[model samples]
Target: MLALLGACAPRPQGLMRPVVAAEATEQGRSVDLLVATNRQVVADPDVRYGNRRDPHLHLTAVSVAMPKGRPEGTVQWPRTTPPQPQTDFHVTRLQTLTTVAQGRGWMRQHRRGGHVLLFVHGYNTTYGEAVYRFAQITADSGVEAAPVLFTWPSSGSLLGYNYDRESTLFSRTALEQTLRLLANDPSINQITILAHSMGSFLAMEALRQMSIRSGPLNPKIQNVILASPDIDIQVFARQFTEIVGPRPRFTIFVAQDDRALLLSRLIAGRVDRVGDINPAEEPYVSGLARAGIVAIDLTRIDDTGGSHHSRFADSPEIVQIIGRRLAEGQQLTTSDIERGGFVMVAAGALHTVGAVVTAPVAVLEAGSRPVPDISGTLAADPDALRTER
Candidate 1:
């Protein structure tokens, strides 16, 4: 188990699908996506087209088709020759945007006055990994919003932690620019920021910089979701304070037994990572409530594989909930929790299974209801339902 966990570290790789001309295939429906990155072009003809360091940001449009059957929980990538019809991502078109105006114009045309979901990847991730992950996420979530990937340069090596952190810091200005461009555009109605692991640190730092330079965040950014964040609790509090305005609906997904973050904590001089917070604890719950943050504790939820750091994306039930809520532009209320059955509502805050419910609670969302049937959404492997924490 430990070996498997350690091997789960992310690394740079070639694009899952090669860039090709736009043409429909028998495999599935094609999804046109817009991507922005700061990685330098490697001048390689292969799928992995970029390297770790680039001074300027670049924009491109890509098309990712869903597998014919539209698999329920995961995005199926083609691995065989002539590619299976039901599962493959065909990179139909790729267009580079030379200027900010061109990028904004492309966004305006593609967005069609709809919402946009911006994804930021985590540590040891490469350009291709980030792009494909967002594609899978968008497809699995069933969100109508335009999908956008904001990729920063990461060394894509397990031992490149310091380099990745430096790269994240270096990319904040570019990320902030991208966000501002989307927020200020009249063609985009809303923007949702979904960040994971160390990416959350970069996302928060960029937002803090924006707040510091331009007052509060733009109103168009309606939601911010942080999953398995690799950030120090103290640093998170400081970053949280920098944003001074009516905050967006901030939601955080935490798991107490996240082994990746356990290692991160040790590396950070024993400081607690935000994603490993114990929501059942009074101080943590109260602090989240005071910050107007909704905390979802997934400690009791079983992970499908790996170190369980990416459980937010691995679990079908959680993915469905996320997709449904994002599509509806609804926050995860106490009622939603009861309906999902993945987690129990204690007091007002969402808690892991077996936590005692109390009165005068710090509820994450509004409303209350009786538990509903979640059998359909539960994982097939009963053993997978049992959590280490």
Candidate 2:
């Protein structure tokens, strides 16, 4: 029934939504986004977009405009003749960054506090999907920082997992170049990476390469939010340690019930995927805490849209929490953590923090009588934690 409903849902008419400038009298919000992609450019005049690896890197500047009176957390695609005239929700001001110097110049011109939020989409995503997802995330987050999307060539097909993995690996050098350019630019202050699913693998590998070739990561990297990362535990540990210099604060969002990652785990020889690690289990929680990794369990949250896989962007509450923290240039706050019904496993702490709504606030102190597993109990009885909005 759910699959039927999903199949029956309305999809945007066109996958490639170019920008359309709004009229002077129109009341709406516009976000100027910088896009960096390694996808091959498709010459189809009907849909001017990029396809999986044309074996070239392209940089583009786009203006995403939300139509007036449009509901929050929604992007509507306007259907028209040329696809770039007065439309409901449109992206305009598309210009290519022909060279690395040009890309750096554009970044310098638009950077805010040297802060850039770079988003890397996960598996089975096309250039259009990545661009639209980043645009939606930027709009919903309400962050003033410059939004950048690093799109690798994902085969964009469900059965293309092997192809996507290879493509992600193939684009590491290009992604590394993009990151190096941003890091070297004096005008860029900090970069917050939000990588989802397989993209997290690419992001980590690029960082690893940068650290190996260059010295340590540039201090410009402030925070890294790994949303439902589809990575192996052992591989992630190696990448984490290989990163030289001051480590960026890492916040990982995980859900044991994430079906996508469940499939990923099966495909990867049944090894535990980092995103689905059960924090209640020993060694994993302790290891994550000792490594200074902040893990937030979203299994109990009921607000996720579509699937359990994308709660990071799908859930309004989660999105707001992430946006607020990133916008303030800080880690997850006590209030933010608690409000999201999230349990934080801080470094050197054995027990998790935060009280679910409608439940008594309790602290699970280390060495205290077999600490009641907060995430486990909540996962078992999520209804009790849900609060009426």
Q: Pick the candidate with the highest TM-score.
A: 1
lDDT of each: 0.69, 0.68
Candidate 2: tens digits of C-alpha lDDT, residues 85-134: 44456655567777767777788788877788899999977666677678
**Residue 358's C-alpha lDDT in candidate 1?**
19
Model 2: number of backbone collisions? 4
TM-score of each: 0.81, 0.80
What number of clashing residue pairs does each candidate have, in the order they appear? 3, 4
Q: What is the Cα-based lDDT of residue 65 in candidate 2?
A: 66
Quote the lDDT for 141 in model 1.
Answer: 72
Query: RMSD in angstroms, all models?
Result: 12.2, 12.7
**After superposition, candidate 1 runs with Cα above 4 Å error:** 6-13, 16-26, 47-49, 75-90, 326-328, 340-389
Question: Model 1, 30-111: lDDT tens per residue?
Answer: 6677787878777653344454676566788876656567655554554653334445554555677776677667777777
Error of 1 at 313 (Å): 1.4
Clashing residue pairs in candidate 2 (N, C-alpha, C atoms within 3 angstroms): 19-91, 19-92, 40-54, 114-189
